[model samples]
Target chain A: MKPVSVLKVLSIGLLAAGLVGCGKQETSKGELIVKIGSVAPLTGPQAHLGKDNENGARLAIDEANARGVTIGGKKATFVLIGEDDQADPKTATIVAQKLADQQVKGVIGHLNSGTSIPASKIYADAGIVQISPSATAVAYTAQGFRSALRVMTNDRQQGKVLGEFAVKHLGAKRVAIIDDRTAYGQGLADEVEKAVKAAGGGVVAREYTSDRSTDFTAILTSIKGKTPDVVFYGGMDPQAAPMAKQMQGLGLKARFLSGDGAQTQEFLKLAGPAAEGVSASMPGMPLDLMPGGKSFRERFNAKYGVIQNYAPYAYDAVNAMILAMEKAGSPEPAMYLPELVKLRFTGVTGEIGFDERGDVLGGAITLYHVRNGRWEVLDTVQGESAGKSK
Target chain B: MDIFVQQLINGLVLGSIYALVALGYTMVYGILELINFAHGEVTMVGAMVCLAVVGWLLGLGMAVPWPVILMLGLGAAVVACMVLGFSIERIAYRPLRRAPRLAALITAIGVSIVLQNVAMLVWGKQYVSFPALVPVVRYEIAGATITALQVVIVLLSGALMAGLWLLVKRTGLGRAMRATAQSPELAGLMGVNPNRVISITFVIGALLAAIAGVMVSAYYGLAHYYMGFLLGLKAFTAAVLGGIGNIAGAMLGGLLLGVIESIGAGYIGDLSFGFLGSHYQDVFAFFVLILVLVFRPAGLLGERVAERA
Candidate 1:
């Protein structure tokens, strides 16, 4: 019995040592390990889009590592520490702190504006550079957090274009609005309301729903009574698809419009034939029209199977951070902060740079209509024109 | 006026699904006096199974009729949920039968969480869209539009409720169930086989939940693992408001809750002078629950009976 116990102890010790050896990082003799964090809702209803964002960042890191990055004259290997926030604000802050504790030089997400707005303070406190790929709420960048920046057009631009197009182009006189009550949705809806009233369209009805709600018949039925020529929904595809179906089921004649959240292939698949005639605004040129868009999409599709909506933007976000770090010759957040502010490059989306407020420069909003079960680009409006119209 | 009619129709459609699910909770509570919190997950399993079968059948590219495909999915969902319900009672609750009531309640909640995680694993955390199996046709009545599916849902739910009522009121199995509920030891001595009756009650309740699950997924045109969470909550509320363990009360409570929620959402803005919006619909449901609890603790139909401890 004594001999058997000694053998068991020896085996257990050996197994523990082996597990520890497996966890040890494989680095070259002098290779500097740089960690970049990616935070998004990797689970829940919006997981498809969140995973798309993470995959985009991963692709950039892989490419950077493959090509070999150097910081401060030392060869660097980039690693991504992806965290799931589950798209909740409280969870996002917790994830932000986790990444901060891990000393990630920069973070590429907290995808929703609701999460980003709250998480930004944590990143700021940590002195970590944070860039969001898809958050569009105006308040995100307006909070005076130097750590905050976004690669996509703000809701002000997208909402203006949508509101203007609905009245000026679609000839909508009275427009009804329904928002999912998230920071992103409500902010975009507010901006659209201003644009609609400015464009000489009467605001008929304003309704609200939760992000998790699938039933909109009560609200939709309420909106139908006002007889608006167009109905605008500021929400994501999960709710949008069912709302579209319910709209048809209730025999509402109003045309439906939404923001970038509804601009997804998943929307077309989920909404089915009901997707026809629905319009949405995405905050970039069409993918094929971007300078590196075609190649990036092919590579992304080859790897991830689908682009979702914000993969290109997320890809650009990672590349921007890398370019800033390379320019600064250091991976330190403070060292690269100034370089990132002035960084300009032709990315997969377009020419990427930032204003003093860290808002993307010269962003364009593209309007699309669902035709024959596909998103067909209808119009593209530059930032100046989009703002000037309102 | 037309808006009122439209909202009323909408309320009825939503209410029917709630009523069906509430019956499951009520039936289980009547026999075991345990909440059976996993009943909602059982409903979710029903939806997921039905969608999975429908997706598989569609993938097979057979020349089967759409109704036939839907029926096949429903049948699979019913069988799966019945088995799941029976096992949940046998495996999770049976041992706790003589334990403290709190122990059984906590175990029911644990079962609910386990089932939710299991479902999330089987069907990844994404909303699965229900295919447009039934070709939708709209009919106008009293200046309100109702779809063929909506009409079918109301009719089917009503028929099922009626069948459940008859089963409870007139059947021998139901008598055994009542006897067991009254006193398990007494029923055992009377040769009623209390265990068998309890199991059958669970199976029957699961059957109703499965049908309700399908109806909800069909009406909403989507299904998700988390869908059962909110749905189960609302159904439980319906059960409590109607008087837990009461069949007819569950149905009445469900319809009233649905109508109240719908009407509240429809006119909330006007009612509050535009200070509040339709999103407050859920607040109204809970508010009603509070009012009922405060005013009538025994619920609308429940009679004050001595605790069975």
Candidate 2:
């Protein structure tokens, strides 16, 4: 009886050890998880724009995983971890530090320039590659951060395009500039001022407004007194729409023009009939011109029940990052930095390639005019070839 | 001269909305001595509720004209806001009646955060366009072009303020509110349900705020999740400028601040100094607040005895 009981105890010990060994094997199999972090304002005034960017990243990661992209000769998967920065620079910096602590391979977001500027510095210091789909501040790439790349064109290019269009197309002798006093807005305003002056067009007046301000009658009145032929706005859609309406109300007949930030349907809704003839320049292939744009529009509408404004650039941003990782043959951001610069791929936006400054080289800005309450593409000009156009 | 007149008219129209929202802040503070941070979110919720109702009506194959749609949307918003005000008073504020002032303020902030997140989750954090219920008609008055909607907002706000004044001066509920504000314990002992009076005060404040929200959404044609933050802060500033507990003072203060901000942005366009821009308007308003606080701490119409005490 004693011998039989001793054998029973040995059998029980063997079973426990075998079960522990199986658990260890499962843990080892899950150890190679590579996480890509996206930081944006998921819960603030700018949450809509942030969510759009996050969805782009999520779609890109999902497509990459489904294709079974191999890294280091082993099957690898991409995991997206999103952090809400609330569009605040301080919050963005903290979120950046948290992402860096987690050793994320790359980051795809932070939509606003105010948040992106500080967050970029943190990511650079941490040697993590960061790409922003919507940030257009000129100083974003000027910070000498090798890892910081913007999928969208800078405000400088956008401003130049608008200034040229005003001078050549509209035949404007004098232009007025107004900015909403954000980093992107002021930067774009300065760029437009410089371009306008260089094109021998005089700036009649330059004005500014705050992001939270609703009443722009005073600024419109000041601009009306100048009697400029054109008014260039460097701001997002929210302030730009009201400014357009108020300008029209104050009898300012100047042709209002703005950059990519003002290209959303909200602008038309806010400005109403006053938005007619207003022009805006945006980066990437225009929605109406993309090859699969019709299907993308239909699918996006079906999935989210809303039309997207910057969907293609967002899609391209994620695709570019994924391709860069595949070309580098490693999931580590530092290992893929040089490979990212060398990678050339066809994307939804156009042929995607990086310049020495990490800007999308040879990318074109599409001109759009709000006609009959819808955005109509007017022209497209490549940045590098813009000077040769004249 | 024409441009100046137009700008002044525009400023007044915008200021009227600010004043309406400011009245809500002033009244709630006057009685409870607590700043309802969630008041701004309440306004946002009102706007969202209006949007949802309009969308629902449109979906239901209702071919009613826009004016009727506007009325229905606004009515739904008011009901929802009143119910929300009542629940907030019952759950968040009522239990803290005898708690420290700081505790109530913190709880209000928490409530604001919860409302903002809940809105994001439910609405998916997108900017939804508010239906244009009012006809887009511009009437030229003395060279100043004002939208019919703008005129409606100003008149409606004025009517609401006058009605509030009459209610407080003549109604039994007003007397009860005044009695509770004077001394909650004494009012409670005098057969007045202080809790009920407080709840009524919150409901009235929320109604005013909801009206302001609907008007602004209609005027702007865009309703966003965080639309209330800046407006809320500005309304609070207006309330304080008018002697926070004084009703008439808030209205006057709001209009005055709006006009000042307009003029500042117009005549002060110095690019080198960055003086006359919209960004500096907030700075200008706060500067005015500081000056007023230094010179007239009790506000323009504040009771000296109450403020000093």
Candidate 3:
């Protein structure tokens, strides 16, 4: 009887604690505490990029809080609630639901398209705006989710620039393409394949690999038999770096090309000397060439060590959401959602605006090649005409 | 012809590492009849340990030669994994020896997961690069290139396998080990310490796995905490393909599996009319396993053993 009484008392106390924890009260007389969610793979192979995005969002939040933003006649304090999705789709949706339940007004991430596509619906249903900093799959925004948008250009624009450059600039007549089979990688490869054909280059081989694979010898050997002039990989640095090394080892003389996922500092480090002569395409202009890029880079580097990739876009994502909140005069998602869709500004990455389908408008793609262990810009292609071509 | 040669080279290199790892699984399974799932994590730990040492040595800015640094790293990885393997068996497996076989299997998995997460914490989640310790010198043969490292891997693996075969066949400890494998109780009655033999077996397996780990990291040019999972899985598949408790079977199975995977990946697109690409390489490995188990349950080189039940 005494043990049962003790158990009843413990259950009652737990229920009361849960209720008290769930209830929120605003304090300090019109000082609004706005919760913003940032989701990325904080732990995994892509953690470096994910952490860069988180740091970018944090820097924006810190700057906004320091400046003391005002929303609806109240002083606003932006609080970033960072969640690790581990770059997994299932984990991304769980994190999204958690953020939604936590009443976060906006989300500044989901770094990969596979995670973003599934999580976008959860955010939309919850009336929270999701501004992805790095997801590039075109299907992400084309899903008709009003709350979905991105600060960076989508894969369609980036892939076209890569394909045309491989043919017209690199003089590639026969091309080989490989993708990691992720939504983002496959989508970009599809676009690159189409653009290569349109640019009068023949695709000699099309191969697929998983994102987790490190061995590429068998596939590379198969592709080598075709003797393609250039080999393009649609995957992140983790897989791409190994492929590059293996290609070199196999005496495959074809030039290596990749999308923005491999245009990263980690790529150079992992691939070592094999990274030399590898060409890659990234969205947006060269960082130094962007409007506010130089100064922003110094500040970001001073705070976060080095920018891996997508940090500038992540910064702009948070800034755009905050600007929308300021314009709408409320931090509530419903109030700022419409303003966010129509917002336009010059960001660190250059002009930031979304089209009807939520893809960035008038974006640019930069081509780079690794030389002497560093990325050097080869050319920059504006996406306005490319967008029309799509 | 060039494609065939290139893929053969690739498959042999890949298979050699698998054979080293499968030997660990087969040895443990031979004696204890328990699948030591954590054997894979031990391999991962070996790689991570070696890389950490290499990174630390390079950071010291000492003028030690590259080969010296490579040897030192390999030495440290082997020693560390030997101790780790012993501790894992002592702490996780020995206590459960008399328990149900299922319990020991579950504990092995638990130890594996713990090792993976612990490695993730120590090494962080980034793919740590393995520096080019071995100088790259490629030789072109029939339009296919083979690096000095590839030749070393195959040669070293062959030497190690021959050495291991001699150890198991001609050594006194091998007689003790074989006796224990037959019956632990009878071996104990015959004055062979089963526990000691088992611990020694784990240490030897760890040594081979450590060397295999370093080879894989060098070959792939990067090491990650999760690298062990897939590598171990493939090696386990190899062991089963050769016949799970047989050492010779593991070796044969590993090389066969590797060649099968490489050639399958090379020709899968053609065989399936472009419907299935080389990404189905993993499928070929498991598919072979299924075919072998269905037709020849004892494996390619495995002998049929009567069940006690």
Candidate 4:
């Protein structure tokens, strides 16, 4: 009887405590806490790059709060809601739906081009601003969505630079290409192949593998017989790293070429010295050369160890939105949407402005090659068409 | 001709891994008449455990030698996989043994999903690079380059297969296993503990899968939570192609499939006149499977199986 009485008393006390807890949780130091979403493959093969992108956004949010950002005459706190899309287009749409449900003021990611393209329509339907920091596929922006913004140049520019560099710089007379058959990989490969043909280089063979493929023996065997001096892979670091190793295994002397997906410390380590002399291209200026890069790198290193190639663009994408928010004097995405489309500001990645299609104006592409087991910048190319490669 | 030789070399190395995994599937199916779909997930657990063990050693600032590290890692993976395999049988499959076959099959799939999710939670869902413990030294034979790692993989798998054959043919436990596999009730009457035989079979299969996991991941220098999915399917295909319940058939089927896939992919584009390419290599494997089934429905080596009650 006594124990039952005590249980009743405890239940009453707990109910009162729960009500009080709920009452006290709503008020905050942040008068206008705006929610922003960042989506990436935060838990998959591309997780390293995805986490780096999220960390960059998280940093910008923290620094913006630390800087005492104010919106609508009230102190504002920015909240970053991170979602893992698993780098699959299906998963990306699901994440986009989740962020839309949260009614986030803006969205900062959906990293891979395959992911970004599918998610753009969802963001557009929700009228939420979406800016990708690392999607390099040309079709991502070509869809003509206002909410779709990217800080990096598209694959068209990247492929042009890659093709020209392989031919003029590496002196590649014949080139062989392989891709993972994904939207991003195939799109980039197609652009490179088109560039190669336009430049009067012999396109020996065009082959593909799935993104999950681990063995490249068969494909490499075929490519080897073509006797190409250069082999280009349109895929991420995970496959690229292994392919580079396997290429060396089969005694293929062709230089490995790829887009930004392979240009990372992960690739270098995974390839394990087989990465030497392999050239890759990435959009935006090199990290060390960026205006705010040194401090950003130091701060990022303090929290998250290494920058896995897309953080600067992520930081810029975030800062770009913040800049628009500042101009509009509001954190509401609808109000700031126009301001973002007409944005003109210098970001960590350099000039940040969007054309009508939401492409970064005057976007630049840079080429890098692994030297002595470290990536060194080769040259930067801008405003170059594929036909006029050199 | 050089291309053909190169593709052949590539096929054999790739086939060795498939055979190792396929042996596990075929052996378990032989003993239990159960597909054990979670068998692939066992390989993932093995690789993850090995990586964790090696990572712990390296992180501890221990000056352990590479061979010792490899040995310890292999040991940990084998032990972990055995425990996992035993528990999966006891908890998931054993309950449904007396139940319908479809129930057991569904449970195997459930167990697979459960193991995948569990591994994803334990080891963060990323490709944790299995550090290169094996030295990558190259040797060219007959215009085909073979790395030291490739040599070890091919030779070690061959040795393992030989050992497995001898064990099945020579050991007393193997006699009990065959008796139990033939008729569980009759074997029980004859004083053979079916449960013990089944458990031993599982352990042996797990050991093979664990070793294969370590070797395959080490060769590629990368291991991810989902890496087992494709390899498992390919291995299962090898098992089926070689006659699912036959031991020697799995090894031959695995090697054959690998060569066929490699050669098919290499020559696919030119052979198909630009209508298809190397990316369709997986499709090509299934196509061959269809052709095989259309001709020899009993598979390449499968004996005539009696209808089950």
Top candidate by TM-score: 3
Best candidate according to lDDT: 3
Error of 2 at A16 (Å): 33
Can you write out model 1's per-residue Cα lDDT over A39-141, one digit (the tens) per residue?
Answer: 8887767888898999999999999999998887888888777777888899888878877876778999978888999999999999999999988889999
TM-score winner between 1 and 4, please give it: 1
RMSD of each: 7.0, 9.4, 6.5, 7.7
Using DockQ as the yardstick, the better of models 1 and 3 is 3
In model 4 chain A, where is the ten-residue run with the lowest total lDDT?
Answer: A381-390
TM-score of each: 0.82, 0.73, 0.82, 0.79
lDDT of 2 by residue, A247-324 (tens): 765667799989887988778877778789999988766665765677666756665655455556676777777777
Q: What is the C-alpha lDDT of each candidate?
A: 0.88, 0.79, 0.90, 0.84
Candidate 4, B1-309: lDDT as tens digits: 878888898899989888999999999888888998888889988999999999888888788899899899999999999998888888998888899899999999999999889999999876788776777788988877888888899999999999999888899888888898899889999999998888888888888999999987888888888878877888888888898888998998889888889889889899889889888888766776777667765568988675731
lDDT (10s digit) by residue, model 2, range B33-95: 899888888899898899899878977887788878878999999999999989998999989
Clash-forming residue pairs, model 4: none
Off-target runs (Cα >4 Å) in candidate 1 are A1-135, A146-148, A291-353, A385-390, B306-309
DockQ list for all candidates: 0.63, 0.37, 0.66, 0.54
Docking class of 4: medium
Off by over 4 Å in 3: A1-134, A292-354, A385-390
Native-referenced TM-scores of chain A, all candidate models: 0.78, 0.80, 0.81, 0.77
